[model samples]
Target: MNYDDRRASPRYPLRAFAELGSSDREWAAHVLDISYYGARIALLDEYNLCAGDPIRLRLEIPEMQVPEGMLPYLHLEGTLVHQQEHMLGIQYEPASELDAELLKQILANLNK
Candidate 1:
């Protein structure tokens, strides 16, 4: 099987504000879908950014599992790898142990 067939990912919609800089310049975007590894985003506005631009995207997720949670999504440093129209595909810059574990579980679930 190919890699895509071997790995399973979740597809969910998230409302978020994407910032280009540390300063609070934000843009509204929709989470097209997400795997534990990375995500595909559809931006509402047009942005002229190149590949390898380090960007931090705040993914807005609903808080229902815990009473007190800081943020729904983990902080990620993304490298722009692919782009098509308004959609962008990025790979996590440095995926941690937790991210790797979660991705493994997600892929296992998807294959099963």
Candidate 2:
């Protein structure tokens, strides 16, 4: 994808495992494909997601998911953007200032 496009993007490939959550519902046991403002997460069996569904995310970074498996955890509030097969795509809500800044940097780097 072209980072210079008006669309938001990520700097580097962020590979991590994610657990999806929502008010009154939680789905765990899956890895997520993450970027700056969104993600495509693989769901475990028995989970059904749809467009317009709001969600929460927990991303476990590689180092955290392997070896000692710690740190780089992320808590995100987002909404479903799309879904295909077993993958659920989401767009993050603008919540924390820190997260917004970080996402901005990630996209900026992608332009380089």
Candidate 3:
């Protein structure tokens, strides 16, 4: 509950539906928490993720407030940084300006 001291960016708890992997091989995951640089997700299926595997994430949180010109989609190209059981820690690549702004907006809304 106290991730404030360690993370570069504050982590926000979010229960959002997400999709991982490429178009041909996608899996359902629930985003448990998110930050500017990384996220923790729970895989719905039994597939185990390997570290350093290139993956793409597509998250949708319909209830969260979104900034103007920003869609509800949160997409990122990331790598599996760590894993434990059914959960995964993904470190995202640098985001586009639009995505960065959108994430900031969502965090602000969540904090409120």
Candidate 4:
């Protein structure tokens, strides 16, 4: 079966820089795409992350403008669900209402 067919939600193509953090370390990652429940990312460096490992992600959206000293980012917590070479798939945990709303807005903008 195709990967999209197995997903719980539709994925939107998104290209952005991000930071992926695990309990012991962090890596610079590139956001390939995202869905309400998960995201696909490519790490800039090598690391040994496996399926079911917990992780934190902070996506930096360049299109969104913020005040001085502030950064426009979306922070999410998830588990590693898939990995191949430098790329990995993440299944996000349930987010707060604010985060959910923000994600929805981002997805909507992507469609335009």
The candidate scoring highest on TM-score is 4
lDDT tens digits, residue span 39-108, model 4: 9999969897899999999888766633335437778899999898998999995346666666777888
Full ranking by lDDT: 4, 3, 2, 1
Model 2, C-alpha of 1: deviation from truth (Å): 13
Candidate 3 structure quality by residue, lDDT tens digits, 25-58? 7899999998888899999687756888888998
Q: Give the Cα error of residue 60 in candidate 3, in Å.
A: 0.2
**Which stretches in model 1 have alpha-carbon errors above 4 Å?**
1-25, 65-70, 93-112
The alpha-carbon RMSD values of the candidates against the true structure, listed in the order shown, are 5.2, 5.3, 3.0, 2.7
lDDT of each: 0.55, 0.63, 0.80, 0.84
Query: How high is each candidate's TM-score?
Result: 0.58, 0.66, 0.83, 0.87
Cand. 1 TM to true fold: 0.58
Q: Worst lDDT window (10 residues) for model 3?
A: 1-10
Better of 1 and 2 by TM-score: 2
